[model samples]
Target: MRIPSTRTVPTRSRTAVVDSVWSDAKEFLTQFAQESRGATDTDRRLREVRSAIEATGTYRHTTEELTFGARLAWRNAERCIGRLYWNSMTVRDLRHLHTADDIAEQCVEHLRTATNGGRVRPLITVFAPDRPGRPTARLLNEQLVRYADDPRSRQRTHLAQGLGWTRGDKDFDVLPLLTRTGRDDTPRFHELPSDAVLQVPLTHPQYPAFASLGLRWYAVPAICDMALRVGGVTYPTAPFNGWYMGTEIGARNLADTQRYNLLPTVAQLLGLDTSSDRTLWKDRALVELNLAVLHSYQQAGVTITDHHTESARFLTHIEREEQHGRTVAADWSWIVPPISASATPVFHRYYDPPNPHPHTAFVHHASAADTH
Candidate 1:
């Protein structure tokens, strides 16, 4: 929608139908009307919502409201540092589709649309939400697409294998999309076609042999398995994506102890002294690895940001938000870059601690079992 603002969002309901749910919905609609600058008819919409709640157990969000709420969720995401472009994200309304097959198909489409031939775009595809009598469909992968056989994803890999999927003998195979229509439905797996999944192979700018390590990462990091809540409505299958920050691939995914643990390998390739931690071999290797990630994505014509630039943009986002009469909520540990945490401007300040409020639109963390 080009960020002009149009989103429809609904909530998962249990017992809040008559009392708490309506109260939460009222609070959200009020804020939405206030922020909408009186474009919305708060009184009329409230009446409609009140009627819907009395007749059914839930109220549906208008498409415009959904779009706005989705963007609001992005802005309110406490752990994210790239919220400056939250409003720019595309909200795909696929709420009508509730089957495992339909969701898998649109997920593939979501990847293609977000990838945008290496020019990654921020996007979210909201699938059918849970309702009173029926459960919602959900994607079972932590991400819509992930490299196969990575140590960190072995649990998911095994789950796919248990579902009668074969693992190809490739270093970085894209795992199949696992889905479940409801709590009782047996999960299904759909392999992602190659054209829909874009990947960048890692190569250092200076080291010619670095490419031999066969390091790679998918272009779009579509976070699946997270629950999207709007006005008390919970969408269990809302998948979203933003362009990668180099450290997400270089500092943590590839270099973490439990993951690929490639720093030691890169250190030897760089001829760094590895006798002890005092040698600072890991430090030298991390910098080069990060450099490689940034360089490779640039050369491949893909969207990626370095830790330094992103941190600066985050501070800008806060300034812009403050000017709009809003306080940007941030978590210090997440706002600070994992690599060179002290050098970034975000390192100099204390941000608002995690203060998530009800009656707010937000994307929330899901349990590990949610991936199943």
Candidate 2:
């Protein structure tokens, strides 16, 4: 699946919302800490942090960038995984161009369109220089320079060596030629193609770039994965439900702090019941985590195993209780049968004694019979 792209507007808006949420969370934590020490500086510190974040725009930009990056990472991860399993194309297929010029043109087009029409050029790699009709690396470089130097060329461009030609070269000085003529010109490096590879860089500017390639609902799994990471779980197949439960509990703890001043209705919506005992809190947290996992898996087109029969039964009971306003007969006797053992072993004999060797048996000596 392609990575989802963020639009200009929502990207900005999401940054703001996430920033606010983080600020509130931090403030709540600080207040809780202060309360433990019986200090009254919570309100002052909260105001100071909020104003600082707002003034510096740090919260907005950082959160926006983070959200974008996470989304991009999720998308690229899916693509990489998909390619591992399914892609039939190879590097040679991608590198096939009619001529060196054609390849250069294709690279230039990609740079322009993909990078927002930036005035940047591509470094082309030419192979097999001595062979008939194959363009020499030197000749290709010259052509790129000529194209960039043309008066009609509104876009400033540059060309540099690719690995195929760069080999054995010691004192290459193409940097000056590729450098911008004026300070206002766009600066883009035409790195050797070997420096570039098929794998997406985690630090690429587009790492956080958003695209609307798939359904928005597909984001649930991605977000859940991020949530898991935030809670310090490293392995995907680990008991992520427990980690999610811990996160919910942490969020509840934050909500209960005086700094949050969370509305009772909002708290309830978030699965936080202030009056619940510690044991109930733990149970509720686990249930919420399980529900989140179920929802996320469903969004990702995964089916949960029928092993959660007990959970299903419990949910059914709760629904019945709400609808009837009274307790109904509870059937807690459901039992899953154990696997049965294999049937009794049957031995197959390959050889059979001669049906009586009647003559030999009749002739058996008295001594032989006694020995037998």
Q: How many residue pairs clash per model? A: 14, 7
* Candidate models: Cα lDDT each: 0.85, 0.27
lDDT of 1 at 111: 97
RMSD of each: 7.5, 35.4
* Candidate no. 1 TM-score: 0.93
Tens-digit lDDT track for model 1 on 257-296?
A: 9988999999999888999999999999999999999999
lDDT of 1 at 285: 98
Off-target runs (Cα >4 Å) in candidate 2 are 1-49, 60-69, 72-188, 193-195, 198-372
lDDT of 2 by residue, 111-219 (tens): 2222222211111121121223432111112112222222222122222332122322221221211222122333223432322211111111121221111101111
Best candidate according to lDDT: 1
> For each candidate, what TM-score against the reference?
0.93, 0.16
